[model samples]
Target chain A: MSASATPVALGAARPGLFGFTRAQAVGFLLMLAAIVVLPHVLYPIFLMRILTAALFACAFNLMIGYVGLLSFGHAAFYGMGAYVCAWTLKFWHLDAAAAILLGGLTGGLLGLALGYLAIRRSGIYFAMITLALAQMVYFFCLEAPFTGGEDGIQQVPRGTAFGIFPLHQDMAMYWLVAGIFIAGFLLIHRVIHSPFGQVLKAIRENEPRATSLGYRTMHYKLIAFVISTFLSGIAGATTSVVFGIATLDGVTSARSGDVVLTTLVGGLGTVFGPVVGAIVTTSMENYLAQFGSWVTVTQGAVFVVCVLAFRRGIVGEIAAKLRLSL
Target chain B: MSEILLETHGLTKEFNGFTAVDNVDLQVRAGTIHALIGPNGAGKTTCFNMLTKFLPPTRGRIHFKGRDITGIAPADVARLGLVRSFQISAVFPRLTALENVRLALQRARGNSFDFWRSETALRRYDNRAHQLLFDVGLTGLADTAAGLLAYGQKRALEIATTLALDPEMMLLDEPTAGMTHADVDRIVELIRSIRTGRTILMVEHNLSVVEGLCDTITVLTRGRVLAEGDYATVSRNPEVIAAYLGSDAPELAHA
Candidate 1:
């Protein structure tokens, strides 16, 4: 490789907490404050469920936003992680952290296999390939012996952290999930601002040019896909532990669509968009559960509005208006 | 004679039954501007594409710096010190001109996979990218997004990006195809001033620009080399003159 070093400096230093823009820091802090205080104000178990889903949405955004890939079947990895965690806890009697790690490993392996094939195509083809693969997994989960057919692996034991602290209480589980969510969120942020993330963006913007510039665009894409899936697995594993069940619902196409909806409602490419989007969408779904098919119709309307007038999503529009890269 | 930095032996490319590039041979010596000129559809761009590994040749071999590069991936070919600029501008439109050049520099340095460090800490690369922008007369527009740049400025930024690769050979396909006279002059001057110790093979439709910039010229007709020499000799060749008689050839034949 030619050692022609050229540093490109554009824009001023971002001023805020942890090198984030002011708005991003403020938004994150506000969300953190809410999560910290929500248990006292609302049902702790419900808040924990929303937080778990939010983490998954953020993980999904890591792929969709930074890598510019729309995966319609992320539920494959999420559902797989949930099943693996439930099985391990129910049979192997593993601790919570170990179960989550095992779930991440399962997701990572699947990502490696699926991403290798999915990255071979681009745009709508990539999305379709992932959806097809996820559907295959969904069928496998429904028929698999360990998954218990329709009943799934029920009454999954909520093992302790390293077999030390008890994870029996909802508050303890909430803190643990919150910690994992923040870490995963920060890791995704770090990856995006890193050189690797820049290459992904370059590939997203112009794959041909990126390839001509000597980047193995496929390799980058696969790596991003794996990381996104791994984080989604973490979220799934946490959900299985907290809720004490792993069901086929986790693997359903609707669940996959739900994550996409959350990311879209928040912002497709913006960093913190998925987090906010997850909380809002999950809360809306909870409140609208009694409305029957109207929830689906309302979600569709939101997607249409976001695509038409607010293509940038809530966070994207704000970032664009401020001339800040979120 | 200068050392040959790039050589192709009977390179051929066929799409279905039609030959896009047929039995083409090329030699580019180090540190010289070699111009490839031909009528439209005469396979000039196809030849450039093959040379850059963008299109796989149906037959024959390409030797760059004495290594067989035929059938290699385009990215690997670029890493071997060969780079090409596109006929239409190919750049990250959302990225600033400086970021585009920086990306090239990052690739050149092989540090693009570093996921832990802040991009701003890549001071050496930033300085070099800035210098490249300055060299391409785009320092003033460094912060401008490539999509927002003027037509001429976008082209200039593309050149800056190509330069950041520090290739041993540069292939420019129709570098001045859609430019005003002033923009053409600026590009020609920029190409002339680049002293990166690399050979430049350019396909140019602007005869005057090629005449002024090229050390040697190859003219093609119907995917065959009809004439090869400096401007004066090829301009007067009978076959070259006959090739120019075809309709719509005047635009490419003007000196």
Candidate 2:
């Protein structure tokens, strides 16, 4: 094969440990440093908001970016995680870690069932199936007696961390939220670089070919979906703990759209794009909250700009221009 | 050799009210190169698809390696050692050439679900992937993405990736379709090199390629077999000539 035969960047992958390109390693360190200092420089709750949303977007990206799936109902997992965590923490009185784990497990189970059905279809139909299933989940939450309907599960207790550290303090809760976000972020990286991730990419790029090559493409897709949903659940559960509420907004379509915006704003397939996108989007929402309905218009404007000026999204454009993979 | 590697009986496919493939019986022997040739709309592709389990035959029984595999998924067919290539050169476009081959190798190893292990664990197949690439003249393009490769290189990469599976029987669906003569010759040689120990069932158009590479030929017309023999015998068959090559008899004869 000739050098000219290969396309640049996306296709011209250089060898790395666990799939980290040189730019990815550098980007990871920068993100680490920023997170360590972020709480001190910014409002802790607001920063936590960004962290939670960031993790959600990153998990969404694993399905969107690596697996070439566009899930319109990801908020289903996120919201479900939040409700499960809140219920477990408040009623069952489980430790924080156990609650989060249980929340993830709940999301995974939901994913397994939904993914089985969704993986039966592809393209727009697949997206619709997920969205419909998520809407059904939303209605379930509404009618369920435990969710408290309109009021939601308010004042969700942060409870004890390993029965020692108190999470009642907002500052104390921030660390756990940040830690979960960071761990999820790194885990996504590990996954995208794994053999399973490779298969996901193969299925994403060309499904029929992957199948002809002896791959159980549907099974691989279901597993990827479950993993993505599990992580999204963890992010949602963490956010519910920090914010002390599990409401309809958690599973709403609008929330689902927000993660899509954040992922797109950062860069769909770029490694660090979703985190950066989350920060940018969260900051923009906070800055524009007083503007009321104008916030949606402003978001529309951003989407317009992103599509027209930067089809690859911010991080994607940067990675393409720099000949790097972040 | 008398051993049958793949045999399909009463294979039929109907699209709504139109019959695409009529009841057809096809047999492929082990360690031989077999070709399915016919005119357009003769259901050659539909037959190949049914044989490879990409399409369910309206009525058929397909046996591979002496096991009834009718209605099996393509993945299962592949596991049974009968892998089919697409009409177009199918590959994971965004992945590097090496990654494309490595995926096939990993799939063959029954470890595609190992999500926790780093891809470095796949490095064990790197040497073999490189060798396969080298075999198809794509060694230097290993790191290049499959989509970015030139058209001819893409076909070569596809073959290299398919070879990574170490299949007992291979299916080539128009392996050289839309290729320059130079590229076509390269594939013909590549196919020949891999045919020594394994069985091959191919659907091909270019008569010269089918003539040069295939050990036996099955000619189809109107979704049914018209002639079955060596290339020379099939080419001379009055029915094969009238139904398919009559208009291009001189051209085919020259080929």
Candidate 3:
């Protein structure tokens, strides 16, 4: 094996942190600084919203951007996580960390079940199956007694961290949310640059070829699906905890659409695109709340502009122009 | 002359009542280049698909290394040290040449499920991958994306990735289908150099490549084996000449 004595040194240099390029490392540092400083400049709650949205978009990007599996019913995991987290905090009296972990587990379990069915088919059919299954989850949430129907699980206590640190303070909750977002973001980066991620990219590039090379493409796709949904669940649970409510809005198809929009606007495949996209889109919605329906009109206009003018989204276009993976 | 490494019995495929490959049996001895040469519509690819388990046979059984493999998955078939290359060069186009070979080399690290570990863990494969590329004369193009390479170079990269598997047997489908003469000769030499200690099953339209590189040739016509022999014996068969060579039989005999 490999008996030839050629000394080709193309891959001699190791990548920067977590396989990130130097530019990407710098970008990551800048993002960290922003996360740290932005809470003081902007309202902490608004910043938290952006953070949760960014986390959710990043999770969703794992499917569409990397694995090429566009999950149209991601709201199932997110909304289910929210409902479960709210229930645990309100009824079980679990701390914030425990509740969120339970919520994330709920998402993962739901993903395992639904992803099993959805991944049986591919392309639009896969998207449709996830949508249908998620719709079922939405209906279950709507009809379930614990979800409180239209009222949802309201006034979910923010509770304490590890039974010690209280999360009632906006700054405390912001820190927790920010920490989750950063962890989720770094975890995703690690996954994307890992050996498993290389196989996933190969499958995305040419699945049949990957299969011929002895990779179980379905298994890889399924695992990626579960990871994506698990993270989406975390984001949703955190949102419910922050807002003190778990409502039907969290499970609506519109939530799924919002995530897809954010990922698209930020960049489809780039590592940091979803975070940038979440910041832009979530900020727009928060600031334009006074403008009512015009917010959607503005969003639609921006989406159109992005699609036509820069198909790569904001980060994608930047990465393409600069020849650096952001 | 040696033990049969791959053997098929009554393998058939039917698509909507149209039989693509009829009941055809084939065998390849271990460590020899076997060629499946046929006319344009002779079911060579369909038969190759069945052997690779890419398509489930309508009725058949395939034995690889004396184990039944007809009912297994394509990836499972590959994992058993029986790999196949596509007629069209099937490199992961976006990946660089080194990355393409590194992909096949990664199975050495057990399974491809280490998503939590950084890709730097895969750097161990770089040297071996580079060697495989060099084996196929792609040393200078290791950094180039597979998509950006010239056609011959892309085909060579495919071979490099295939070699990274170190398969016991390889199924090459039309390894020199569309090529300049120089490229074809280069591929022939590449195949010749890599043939030691491995069995190769190939589908070819280029009879001269078969004559030069293949130890045994199986000629197919109308989804059935028409002749099986070494270069001179099969080339002289009147039926093979009439069906596959037609009026060009004399020129083929000379070749």
Candidate 4:
């Protein structure tokens, strides 16, 4: 095979406005421009909601796409981070950045512990183990008092950054959310291109061969899991601050499934696929809210279609046609 | 005489009540091709597995380079400069041929986790991998994905990967089991070239290939060593003739 036939590095020469690949960078810049400009023309609250979901979807993709590990219980970490941040901000009166960091740490710890066990198996078993463990966390959240159970922790303080800069408005929160999303995206990109990422791909391709080649495959899997969950936690913390709520909905299996659906729709192992998938799916959920059960039916149908006919996903399909690795 | 590189004492394998390999003592000298030929159900592959540390012997001691490594992990065994190629090709299908050799070199050099440097920049590894590919006559297909390579090419690549480890000894189980005549001839030639530097212990079924490539041959039947010596002596032995060729044997009549 020719060297060109192999998948190349992401955003090699043409880094967009936000350090994304040319296409993503261009699309993201346009989206950012729209976020800044269109909010005046459209509703700021609606856009913020979409942007938050997009960030969460991108974080989820860090695991599924780059690492090739399907996490069904990502919502457990996401919801846990959200709850930890919300509770800390509301009861302990912590700053927003600190709360988000605390949320990320919590998610990382959970990932470290759960990933150790889940990575013992591969393929479908790995997915099931993660889902089952996440369910345990979900049950704990439902019963835990700090989480406020069905009521959720409400009126979380969207405290200032470092006690100086106030993020009291939607515009300010949008910038923060966008910045966090971009950072997470860049980190994921760095990891996928790094030598560490190459080993993960090697493991994904053939675990036995990787092991025989002297790799501690389980260690790599755990690290990837932790990184993925930690990013997912950042999204959760941001969501809590933006909406001033933390609930069991974030930790539910359905919520986890939603992230998978988004990643799959965007692209299974593609970098920008999850972001695009998140944006499109969140918008569909928002507009189809009035359609009741049909919204779920429609989402399920999209997932089925993506899996059966478009396994490469929207971003993957585009990349294949254009002969790019984006 | 060459130095002994691999030695086993009381090497035995038991699967439940049945003993697959029973008290087989073996010593492979350096820089010679040692062929272990056996009929079906003979414990040749099991013995290979034991030597490579893939399967722990039920009762035995294996010493490689004067170090006891009876129950070490397979990776550890490979790291110790004793590598084994599988009966079936086990190359990474997704990786290109160069990448596969590069991975082996990385492991052999204990650099499996060197994440910061680009693989392309590792000139030493890249050059050695390229050289090994050339040595195996796979220089033309360096960029081919191992999975896409032809059967003969895959086998050649497997040998190249094994060589990338820079092993002192090689344990190859059925290297030419499924190859065509041309492929088999190519493998025999490759084995011949490789035996100049490292001790090679191979399990082969084809008598002609065994006679052509092996300096010493150990004939096995029903989990026991039936005959041992050079091909000329073992081929003429009555026990080997009875066990391997059976009663209707044209070669035995000539002998």
Candidate 5:
């Protein structure tokens, strides 16, 4: 249509490599290098824990940010992975790779079932349904014979790497955690740039329009939910191996809160936002561990400050200001 | 060419006890510009919603290309080459203009649920998408997000996306609702240019627009069809005139 005035042109550049603009690639590379050398400088176990949490947050972002579905109970998948991985390592004595993958598969199947029910309702209804179902999974985990209730599945063998490395050394286990995190990150990146991901964004932006365009929006949402939950499950599995325990805390509402807080503080939609968020939040908890309950107070303050100061999250604000597609 | 392409029999919709549409039978012949126009609360939108399968009729049936489509989903109806544009501009605001059109083209090609492949394969659609955007006069704004586009430009984007569907028939609801004079004139040209091989059904309020563009007009009042015929014949009907401007005796004009 010929309007009196023409529209302005902004953000016309094509993104590079998996929806990351050139600037985003640079940011990602810098972060990658920092993490690669992180163990030498900081404690390997502490760094490994943060990496695991970061992967979980990134998985959560894929649902809430790209798909526009706020899942407040991501612990269902994360804890499912932890419980399965721990049980397999303790009882079945499976290899680390197989055990972690089994955990991710469990998450996928659970996501498929839960997504079928949760996606039936949207907005607050969708969130409440997921929270309620996740609580059911939590109860199952608490009462299950293998999980050991209060003690959890303790001393989960990290297991050997394809009959090779025993994964007994802390650095060796750190690499395993790092590898899983990197794999999850790359998979999410690939998915976000795929044609399927485009449909997901379309559904997010205006679902009614997308439906009118002949897309079965529900199917797209389900697939995205499965992918996100599967990745999150992997992160949880990796965490149990790193800590040698998969406690009830892993599947609790508190864990879900941690992932949500991490995603928001880092950035909701930015590709690198979750990592930044995970690092900042994990560092705060680690450094303030001596303060006991004050850690929760500090995290709440951080969330408030983040919401007040940078609603787009740190990386999101930067990406918008720079016109980069991060 | 004179055969009916879409027909509805006694289509009615009731929200609670209030009747939004009541026992309306309608038909659209192939390759004609049919306009649906009524005053506010005349059930034009409700009727259009039923035609597009956006809302189910309480007690009626819809036939599209001779297929029973009353129970079909809106997306399935579009898949059958029947497409409807929204009264509100429904472009994905965060996506770039090219990406929006590209997404429509992809859907038209039945590419939904295909996420395993890299999006680089979508580059094959670039030339056609760029052409569609260019036809809509969005030459350099391809990379701009739809939300950043001006109001008129967003409407143009909506048209381009609908056009990407390449429908045999288009159901456009208020294609020029909030446009300026210049924009309205431009959209009229677009509508005229697009109708060489496709049929169009539209809902319009601007009588001049109806008179200038529509080959046939259906006038409604209070959930019932008042008159249906060529624009000149319908406009001259005294009942149509009174129902619009307010009837003197109020005898519940034609239905």
Candidate 6:
């Protein structure tokens, strides 16, 4: 058992550009090219909706995918972000950037309050805790005076982003939404690859092992939860800005389920999976809306198929095929 | 005499009125290999968990480096230079072996909250991580995902990751519980190589390995210390023979 007697094969790891394998880098470029060109081929408003959903799903993935925490009430942050952003934009007359930032802050603050309690219990209990907390927020929105009871905040102004670029034009608003989506996507990517992200992965892999290595697992989980909710907040804020309305529909428990389905279909833990899943699921709802109640049935079928056929989701499967970490 | 590095006073644990570990006192000397050996349900693991602060003792005081640590958090205990490994191989299965070692070494960077900084910042630890791997005979498997490593190799990797902390003392739970003769010998050699300047307290099932490596042995049975001494002295104790060795007493004495 001498050290010299051990086998000496070099590892199979390959260097990549910007931490992405060749395949991932190519996929990223293709996705970016589509982002830029899609406005010309498709409706910009519809695309903006997809971008918001994409960002929301990516933020949700930070919990379930990276940290192995299934947050059942993520829509609480998303819906609250929308309500806050809409309130600021309509009443306070804040600029787009400020409104979105405030929305994210609201989500982060709310996440801190709920996550402190939720992370104390793990697995299904954690999920139940989050769901219960989010439901409370949903009821608060329903009864709150500022939330307009059933109507929500309507006719939200899409003012200039940073008070310079006019966001009244559909293209201008689309660009703003696109910019937010990309920046949020990269930020999530950066967090997942950072030293902090490394600890999160270790905690996700074996929590007791990480604790034995001197990591405060609770603190790490709390921080990750806040960051995730903050991102979800902005995604919600962006959606309201794009649509000019913040409705009860956005805060419904169904929205929480929708985000989960989006991420699950995209690939639960894959970096790009949530975005792909968001696009697929959001597009399905849009196209299937004519069928009314049948939309839920179709989504249920898709969820069943995805779970049974490819548990890894679309991006997870592709990454597995190519042996990449995307 | 070596200075006492870790000591326990009347350590006890009761789960729903069933006494798991009862009124056990343990003293481990600095810079020595101490083995806690006992038969099945002898409370070796329960006692180890108390020392590591994984389980709170119903009645006990633990002193490490002359400081009481019974009430401290488990992470803080590890930060105080006392680390422990699991009975089961506890590697981060998805992480590459280098990444796993680098994770332990990353603690030296302080307050692992650099979420905004790129992970390439951790590349600086590659040399030290590689060296630790080399010491544990895992250099060849550095790039392998820990889940892919063989059982013996994973145990070796666990030791390497544990060593990355450079702790003053280590508590290993069943380091070679399931290993071939060659793997056991290799681990004994590896343990010996890394024994310098650090104290090791291990719960080992293989008596022969303990005989070869441990400076002192503590034998426990049914949650109580039946005998404590050098291998030759304790193996000859009739109480130990009756309680632990039983039918294998002759072979145990020869070994």
lDDT of 1 by residue, A1-326 (tens): 01111121224344344447776777778878987998898998888778788889988998887777889999999999999998999899998999998998888899999889898887799999999999999999999899998999999879798778789988888888888888888888777777787788789778888988888788898888988999888888889999899999999999899999899888877777887787778777788989988888888888888878977678767776776666
Q: Return the lDDT, model 1, position B160.
A: 88
Task: Give DockQ for candidates 1 onward, in order.
Answer: 0.50, 0.78, 0.56, 0.30, 0.58, 0.58
Model 6 root mean square deviation, Cα atoms:
3.9
> lDDT of model 3 at residue B239?
93
Choose the strongest candidate by DockQ. 2
Candidate 6 regions exceeding 4 Å error are A1-15, B247-250
- Ten-residue region with minimum lDDT total, candidate 4 chain B: B114-123
- Shift in Å, residue B95, candidate 5: 1.4
Candidate 5, residues A177-211: lDDT per residue as tens digits? 88888889888887888889889988888888998
For model 5, the DockQ equals 0.58
Q: List pairs with backbone clashes in candidate 3.
A: none
Kindly give the stretch of ten consecutive residues in candidate 5 chain B with the minimal lDDT sum.
B246-255
lDDT of 6 by residue, A1-326 (tens): 01111121113345365556566677889989999999999999889989999999999999998898999999999999999999999999999999999999999999999999999888899999999999999999999999888999999888878979879999999988998999998889888878899899899889999989888899999999999999999999999998888888777888999999999999887778999998999899899999999989999999999988988889877766666666
Residues B1-255, candidate 4: write the lDDT tens digits: 978889989899999979899888888888888998877778999988888877889998999999999867776777787788888787777677887787777766754554444433334677898999999999878777787889999989989987877787888889998889999999999998887678899998777788768888887777777888998998888888888666335544563
Give residue A260's error in model 3 in angstroms: 0.7
* Candidate 1 C-alpha lDDT tens digits along B71-127: 789999889988888898888877778789989988888778776655554457878
**CAPRI rating of model 5:** medium
| Regions more than 4 Å wrong, model 5 | A1-10, A321-323, B246-255
Off-target runs (Cα >4 Å) in candidate 4 are: A1-68, B1-3, B14-19, B56-59, B109-111, B114-124, B246-255
Give the TM-scores of the predictions, in the order they appear.
0.94, 0.96, 0.96, 0.86, 0.95, 0.96
Please report the TM-score between candidate 2 and the true structure.
Answer: 0.96
Interface RMSD of each: 2.9, 1.3, 3.4, 4.9, 2.4, 3.3
Task: Please compute and give the TM-score of the first chain of candidate 1 against the native first chain.
Answer: 0.92
CAPRI grade of model 3: medium
Least accurate 10 contiguous residues by lDDT in model 5 chain A: A1-10
